[model samples]
Target: MTALPQERRVVTAIPGPKSQELQARRTAAVASGVGSVLPVFTTRAGGGIIEDVDGNRLIDFGSGIAVTSVGSSAEAVVRRASAQLQDFTHTCFMVTPYEGYVEVCELLAELTPGDHAKKSALFNSGAEAVENAVKIARAYTKRQAVVVFDHGYHGRTNLTMGMTAKNMPYKNGFGPFAPEIYRVPVAYGYRWPTGPDNAGAEASAQAIDMINKQVGAENVAAIIIEPVLGEGGFIEPAKGFLPAIAQFAKDNGIVFVADEIQSGFCRTGQWFASEDEGIVPDLITTAKGIAGGLPLAAVTGRAEIMDAPHSGGLGGTYGGNPVACAAALGAIETMKELDLNAKAKRIEEVMKARLSSMQEKFDIIGDIRGRGAMIAIELVQSGTKDPNPAATAALAKACHAEGVLVLTCGTYGNVLRFLPPLVIGEDLLTEGLDILEQAFAGV
Candidate 1:
């Protein structure tokens, strides 16, 4: 067996020699608006290992924020994308459609949760998928209002920003946002105003009441939610919450949308997180892991709802570019052949065991929650549930210093989320967990 490297060897500290040089160049050449997770510039990535410019190989736990579920540079994904590039890159689907695009749509219709007749539209990014979902809802319902939940992140676009709940970086100065968008409380169990063990049904009832009272249900076109909130921390909505919301939407003639951008494609042990709850959404938005690492996203929904938008209103210049479609096809094949759903469940078992043990040893670990491979550990004050943002930041910094790449999330920025690629070796996963435990001890 080829031994995977463990115990981070810091050759030249975190950034090292080459990364520092590249960082300066990146500062000069690249747009400052785009943010980077780690300071080290990556040269290559495979499985769960990312090799930096300084020749430092680190375990990647963030998985490009849950994008590369099949792992970066999977053989099939690379081979298929390379072959497609040689054939042709673009000829927009609208201008002249290709078999690759149609094939991806067929796969999506078959894969996404729901047995209803489905239709799909492709887009260039997660935000684009989200934006189009909204347009489709509006066209189908002929309603002006859209309802989003608190701590929910839709996208960076102006309309999505208004639909999103976070205020700082996503919505700070960029609005005057789109009108008729509203926010209600999410079923976040932790930091829940009422109590810790509140039933999901009760939470959903309360939220539904708010919608009915504040924004009449008849006026609402859709309710968009993440089955498991991504950037707002990996908080899975309480059990029964999703089903209840779906029921309310159905009763009120509102479109129920599940934003599975971060939680889809076996990332959550199931094909889609919505499957866990048996909640069939009227629409599902997917991206991230959909096309391996290529820029692609999609909105798959009930045939009636998707068809509501006029033919000419729903595409982009490169929405279903052949290269991206090929990558997506390969990704789907990889997910099946590798049994990534089983791998995700296996990952969750290991994560729960390791992180639960860490919680017993570390007082800062307030809560450990998530399903399948999508897990998070929220840091808090020693004896209270107060968010310990400083300690969380310090722990992440320590992990990075030790050559492990992890990420922080949560509305208060006190949660460390683990989203390692499902293809990662058990030894590497354990080693990364060990690093996190040591970092917590040091903090």
Candidate 2:
């Protein structure tokens, strides 16, 4: 068993001489639009550490944007994926067929919420699964309108780009996006105009009313939302909000799709974030942590709804590639064996206690929120709710320089998020937080 050293040891400056050379190479070889939060290239990453080319052992808190929840190169994942690779990498599920794909879908149907008969289709990424989910919903309902909430991030595809709310990098200049897509207010408790207590009912009412009046619920196919907003700063929509909206969708024939791409697979101390709200979305899109770093996504839902798509209507060449499916099966085994849901809860306890203590000391941390390992702190000006993106940037830079990988995200770009792998040792997790505290002080 080759394992990471599970320690943070910076041998040189943040981006040492070796990494500097790689940066120059990347600048020329990679497209400028492709961005990286931390520029130092990784030589290997597993457990809680990422060893960069510069030989700096940085504590990983980002988890490859929540993809490595079972840990990077997990033993089970590597073993299973390696076995599949040896047999064959791809026959393409759409072209031929494979047991691996069928097994993964069976697992999804069994694991995902709802007792009803369910079915799933695999895809290469979260965006593709989401697009297909929308396709299935529209086909089933015979409607064209799709509703998404504010601060929701679907993907970068033409349809998903229209679904995503952010403008600067995701949507700006990329116009003529897919039409019949409508946006509504999410129950963002922190920044809600009315107040957190009333955010659920008020926001739900507003959203339902808008869908009925503006988009016409009769014409709406799906109402897609993230149970815990990911890039939108890990905002957990207020309690009662998801349920109310789900009921409305049921009243109409609209599919309530939960985009659990970032908050699924034990990341939120549950099989899926929707489970927190007792929301069994008619269709659910999953990815990110599904395969322990492998590229795989699934749209799991009611059997009838999924069957609405014709035989050739919902598949891609690389959809449900055997290697990825094998990896997903391995990841599921690891999750059950390790009881990662409980591990994620423990992480939440540790993080919330530490971050709440920090919040008392530092006024810049306006709000510390999120469930399980998926947590974040919204940076703000002292004594006010004013967003402070500058401070957010400075703090993240400090953490990076000190060999702790932290990521920043928000509609205003003023929130710092922590997504350490569930397999991280307590000592390493604590050390990462210590570095984060030091970063805060320095900033």
Candidate 3:
């Protein structure tokens, strides 16, 4: 294999011939439920570019939906992962543990918010970590009810599906979901009915009231939230909202879980988005950027709470696989070596400025939000707050055709999220933003 160059070069159409052929095979053999944001299949990825099968090098803005935060193939990550692969791959952590797994857990304990005694359990995906967090919370508190916010996305598993707020693709017809899960209003300032200033106090008070009246605090096992809402369009909770909620949970003995699946690692300019507001959660669920591109996730929390589960209750056949643990270590190495938190902050400054300028120029670009490299723009009707999913789709399509990959998200499907790799070059990122501006102009 050759080294992937850090440049966007389009030698063929967006999908080209090879990708289209592969798409046909995928359609016939793969599940219809699995969806693709952009149909371009990649052969190699590094820095800010995804090289597809047809020899088209597209600037990546999605970072595989925030999975490849250190870039698709950071040198440190590849080196460590390759060494681990050469040694050995598996041996369930439960039956036989490895230093790599333990080391990753130690890193999580040190990196996650709160300096108090902490412990961690590993899993394969964010959903597993989240589900385990709830289970641990329930076991520790002896409670039955779980609380989540509107427009938040936890995962796709049966229990997480119940916890997730979206209905169409994530929850539609997937019902018979786990019981005792409750939904409450989130402090989404942009769309707050009473206006942004009142969103913080009002949403928190209403949510607390609902929990008290509808599901008593004694019955609540946990209150889970994304410090910066991920699939919910990167809507950071309004000021005073998260602290208020966290304090309420602490007062009532409810475990406060920060689902940092998409906002963790250096994706949000901080180790975790919870740090942005100085709110320390009782439990934190992390994945995505944790292990570069490998499948690894964890639930780290107060040692007492994490240890509540039975001895044999938490282990899984593949939880904390050695190779993935190695990859996570390497990813952390890259983060520290490059100061990706600072890089993410720089990206946030760059992107927010660019997107804010675009917002000034485009009436459809309603709001610019999110922190660090996880920024997004919500599309709305010309001069109103009404969501415009059609324009969102059109803009994304236009960018994809021009060899710049982007992603669309949110409950109304009106958000264009930009999760460029933290290691992306200033030139490539600026060029991608340029393409995005042109796409908006075309739209």
In order, the Cα lDDT scores of the candidates are 0.89, 0.94, 0.94
Choose 1 or 2, whichever is better by lDDT: 2
**Model 2: residues with Cα > 4 Å off, grouped in runs:** none
Write the residue-wise lDDT of candidate 2 on 333-397 in tens digits.
Answer: 99999999999999999999999999998999999999999999999999999999999999999
**Could you tell which candidate, 1 or 3, scores higher by TM-score?**
3
lDDT of 3 by residue, 124-155 (tens): 99999999999999999999899999999999
lDDT of 1 by residue, 1-443 (tens): 11334334467688898999998999999999788878898877878788888878888898898888888888888889999999998989899889998999999999988788999999999999999999999999999789999889989999999988878768888989999998877788877777656848668988899999999999999999999998898888888888999999999999999999999999999999999989899999999999889999999999999999987989999998899999999899999999999999999999999999998988889999998889999999999999999998998899998888999998888999999988988988998998998998889
- Indicate the worst ten consecutive residues by lDDT in candidate 3: 1-10
- Clashing pairs counted in every model: 0, 0, 0
**Residue 11 C-alpha lDDT in model 1:** 71
Which segments of model 3 are wrong by more than 4 Å? none
Candidate 3: residue pairs that collide: none
Worst 10 residues of 1 by lDDT: 1-10
